[model samples]
Target chain A: MALSDVYDFYRRMEDENVILSFKGEFTSELLTSILHIMETKMVTMGISPKMKKRVFNVLVECFQNLYHHIEATGDSPKQIALQKSALIMVIHENEKIIVRTGNYIPSNGIEKLKERLSFVNGLTEEKLRELYQNRLLKNKLSSKGTAGLGLIDIARKSKNKLGFEFIEINENTSFFCLDVVIE
Target chain B: MEILLLEGSAKTPEINFNQDTGVLELRGRSIPENSIEFFKPLNDWVDIYGSSPKETTQIEVRLEYFNTSSSKCILDLFKRLEQLDGNSTEVKVNWYFEKDDEDMEEAGVDYEAIVDLPFKIIEVEEI
Candidate 1:
């Protein structure tokens, strides 16, 4: 990338009040480091203890979603599963914090994800709480035990409808973008 | 029997379960990428503790932050405690949050609503 291009990118991020942004391989260790970084940033910014905790909690759910849903590549079955070049941004908009994640997903999975997103976005706060409790009690965690728990948790914490977009990358893949706003 | 003691990590919580006093404490941050793997042992210990529980069981949760996965696992641990014979084993959960951490307090309330056991949301001076 040219220096001018890099400067333009930074300017855009600054305009968005992006406190933290990352575009790279998503690993477990990276997630830990990102949380630490975010915590320190929030503390330095003098965010209220309660709001900082809320932002941190929402970020955790977002990072986990990126880790679990980002499509893995390679033909070898023994290869390590890692998300290559996922993007995450924590932006302060007005008095709210917006947690955004962008990653590629298999085309086959996009429909189900869209349905889940729309379902979560359609509910009121009371309904969201009800659904979270119901899922916690009844839903079975898949082999990894993720099983949409993160989504429900995110919805409950944000207390706002989820926003998402699907950008087609190819015949078999699309870039899934999710945004959570915490007031 | 033996006590369960696990040190806290950057991404996991410290678990201290006393077989004698029946005071199980979880402290620190819990954002492990795979929380189920980290919490399975804690959940299993609760199973054993339930079978031969103390008269009064106090579980203290002092987490600064926990991911969605750990949230589910924590609930599982609490659900296990709920299975203990209420007449014989009395379970009380004290959830501690930093002062003014309304989100954490609300989280405790949510957990209280989900589990049948007694849960108290306590505010600490600082994390």
Candidate 2:
């Protein structure tokens, strides 16, 4: 949290081509503001309106996924603190925008998520569209307000594989990170 | 039998559901943290309106962006409109997208394929 440390972090972010990032509590209100900043940044960049709209859509889905991903955290103070620090960062690389998010999830939940991500990433565009529609018709919304279509929607929108990793934090918890590309 | 009107916010959509006219309009963004909760009343209204609906029920969806959660709820809202079985109501949806927003257009197409209602995917200058 020192000034030089902050300067070094800024330098590293610049080096890595990170345009925007947040690492803290992910509330709906806060995410809305983050999206506003991103939309404004895109407007200032003078990118085409089409690309701006597409990137904004992808960003909303990413944060909504994060909302569903980490909102059901453990209630203990330490666990709450750890879960509150969910991460979202946007990277501009090679004329493509990459949106990434990270959050803590129960270790037991990893299998289902991993399966779903792989399922989404492994499909062709046609099959992906069909799968998305099928899921849309079949699955009901869960108690967390997700219908299991977030990954599929992200995959279809990006037209690229969804990159993801899970770092084990403890026997009962793991840190899940997801990267989605916006072309 | 009252009109349901809710103003839009940074993370929610503007809703104008007229029970008498059977003209429901949903505009703006719908990225609420919990869309199921946000849309429950509207969905139920569709069901209640089904009980005594106008001859033509027109729904206009001019959403700039909606989260995945809202996407499902939006579909459910459409499904409710589709399930109105009486001859008194003929339901249709106008899913409007900005001309440059191919994603929004495709979103309309996606819903059209899944929901068994008449959908007119129209292109507009802006929402």
lDDT digits (tens) for residues B79-125 of candidate 2: 88888834588988999999888888988999988888889999999
lDDT tens digits by residue: candidate 1, B40-123: 888888878777889999999998888767777888888888888495789999999888777677779989998998888998
lDDT of 1 by residue, A50-121 (tens): 787778788888887777766677466532243356899899878888999988787889889899888888
**What TM-score would chain B of candidate 1 score versus the native chain B?**
0.96
Error of 1 at B64 (Å): 2.2
Can you tell me the CAPRI class of model 2?
medium
CAPRI verdict (incorrect, acceptable, medium, high) for model 1: medium
Q: Show model 2 residue runs off by greater than 4 Å.
A: A71-76, A169-173
- Candidate 1: residue B121 lDDT (0-100): 90
CA lDDT scores, all candidates in order: 0.82, 0.86
- Output the number of the lDDT-best candidate: 2
The stretch of ten residues in a row with the least summed lDDT in candidate 2 chain A is A65-74
- lDDT at A90 for candidate 1? 90
Listed per candidate, the RMSD to the true structure in angstroms reads 2.6, 2.1
Tell me what fraction of the real C-alpha contacts between chains A and B each candidate also makes.
0.55, 0.83
